[model samples]
Each structure stands twice: as structure tokens, then as C-alpha cells.
Target: MHDPIWQAEKKKILTRLSIAIYKMTDEQLISLLHLFKDLNLKDNDKLLEMPHSHADGVVAARDRQLLIARFFLLINQLSEADLLKFMNRYEQKRFSMLREYPRVPCNITLDLAADGRAINCSAMDISAGGMFVESCESFTMNQPVSICFSLAEDQLALKIKGRVIRLEQGGIGIQYESLTKYQIEIMKNMIDRLQRQASSQYRIG
Candidate 1:
């Protein structure tokens, strides 16, 4: 019941499935991806009664291999139209709008507690999640860093704790960590209003 080989084989099957889907025409590709999705969602429904193993404890490994190869060949031609429809439906539901927020050049100071390094950087963008500060130096990934940045004036300045989630050529990605209830409330209201305006514009377009 606790066989590692079976797990490896299953992984191989899924990998093959992904490769196959990427190779199909748009319509055929959509159908193949849908099959996997259905398998995940309707496993208990017994849609396709495919035999997994023989009575003699022998797996039909050869047949499964051929089927995997064929699936890959068919998936090579999936249509872009079908791909866009699927993506739009999924992404739009998850994110209310796909608009990028307007970013103005602003100077911000960052103090990293790990090294006691103080650096001045320009902000690339700002959203409720966090802001991207343009810097050439890379910070430790997943490192907790203290950031004290002023916006507009000292009245709207933010002193927040954040974690560095990613590092890239331009700058590091930060996710905000520390904030008082009042700060969070203010940010949420601002973000909701901005997103609503963006969503309205998206609909008009």
C-alpha cells in the first residue's frame, strides 16, 4: 500500500500529460487539459473505467506508456482562442481587475536590520500588497527586513516590517508584515477605491 514506485509512475504520467497538452491544436489541447481537470474533480464518478493493473499484479506499463506518448502528440496543437478564453475566465474571477496601478517616482529609504545597511532607492510601483523599490543590490531571499519609507510627506510616512520574497535584476520583492489596525484599515479602503475605478475602466475597454 506504501509503494514509492507507484508514486513515481503517477508523477511520470502527469508529466507526460502536461507535455502532451502543450503539443496539441487549440481545441484538442483544451479537451486534453479538461480531461485532467475532470479526473481531479470527478474521480469518484467513475467516468472512464480504465483498468489500472492486471489480476496477476502486473501493471499495463507498456500500454500506459504508448497512451502517454499519444496524448503528448495530440496536445501539441491547442488553439490560442481556447487558451485565452480559459485564462480570462480563471484570472478575472481570481483578480477583480488586471490593470496595473499608476506608479510615480518617489524616493524611499530602507534600513535592513540584518546588516544595519541604510539605502536610498526609488519606488517602481505601489499597491496594497507592497511597493517595489528600485535597487541594484540584492537582499537575502525570504529575509525579514525593516523598512521606513516616507510618502508625500512625514504625515503619510510608513514604518513597516516586511519579508523579501524574491530578488531580481531590478529590485527585490517585499511582502508587508507589520502594520497597526488603523494603517491596515486605511490601506484597505484606499486599495478598494483604486481597484473599483480600475475595474470600471476595464469594463469600458
Candidate 2:
């Protein structure tokens, strides 16, 4: 067990990364999920990668789900070039991208675009054009979805319409549609903020 304060304290820094972050199609997320689950990862501070032997049932089982969110949030913030380098290690399988705007790590909820069915989901990353959301709910490719999430520095929640461009076992890729002028501005500003933060950290580090 860890302190909750750690999550809140590290939220800002953890969310921004100096890399190319792209949305993943559901097909790709499923594969990535499987790939990561079996990884013999060293115990890193930002992520929880418990060894399978020490992983008892129940608690570890629950954390694995959380791990999916945590791990992918980290993954989504990696530069596309970096991600490709990492994925290329899996020579047998190639990870594909549906490409548009780069993604910034974000946590948000998803709603049905047509009927506003609310689903609790975390965003792996986001962009003015679209985002990648992780959820186990049953949804088909091309389904319409509405995203409701807040920028790290802003309290105001953002709602935008998107289409499910792709699907994977653990998440879905959404492509923005009919974005308003205001929404576009919000995304641009947020992206700028993340970029600025990442650059600042680079200089400091």
C-alpha cells in the first residue's frame, strides 16, 4: 500500500513528458496489454510491476488493472520515435498507429456521444484532434463517444465529441469530429502548457 498524497503530488510532473505521444487503436492496446502483463519488470517508483511469484491473488489482481492505466499513461507520453524503438523489440509483432495529433497523458471519463451513457475511463493521452481511452466496456469500432476530462492546470472540465476509430481489448481510439472554435483553443492551450512543462523539466534535469 502507498500514500494517496504521492499520487496527487506527482500528478503534474508525471503527466507531462518530453516525447511524442500518440493515440492507440483498440487492436493495438489489446496486444500491448498482453505484452506488458508478462513482462518481468524491475520494481520502478512511478509504476508498480510486482513479480509474478510475489503477486498473490486479489490485491495483485486489482492492481494489475490499475497498472494498465499507470503503465499506459507512461507509455502514451513517450515520443513516437521512442515508442517505436521500444515496440520494435517485439520483433514478432509490430505496433501500429492510427496517426493524427500527438497525445499528452491525461485522465478523464468517456460518455456516449449519441445518448450520453457515462463510462468511467482513463485517458492514456490526448490531443486537439483526438485521444486514447482505456476501458473494458463493450464498444464497437466506429462507435461515437464524448470525452469529459480536465486539463491538469485547469479546473474546468472539457467535453468533446469523437468517433471510435479503432478498438483493442483494454481501450479505444477516438478521433475528434465537429470541434468548436472554443474547444480547439482549449486543446491548443493545454498542449502548449504540457510542452512548456516538459521543456522546463528537460532544462532542469
CA RMSD for every model? 15.6, 18.5
lDDT of 2 by residue, 1-205 (tens): 1457644534433343211112333233344545544443444444534423222222233444564576666554544444445455433444233232457776555444445567877777778767888888877777777777766545777787678887888988878765555666678787777768778888999
Q: Candidate 1's residue-wise lDDT over 1-205, tens digit each?
A: 2368755754565565474333322223233434534324333333233435444333354744554455444333323443334444434532542243233233445543435777776655555446676787768886777776544354666676777777888887776653444555555565566567668888999
Local distance difference test scores for all models: 0.51, 0.58
- Measured against the true structure, the TM-scores of the candidates, in listed sequence, are 0.40, 0.45
- Candidate 2 versus the native: TM-score? 0.45
**Highest-TM-score candidate:** 2
lDDT of 1 at 75: 30
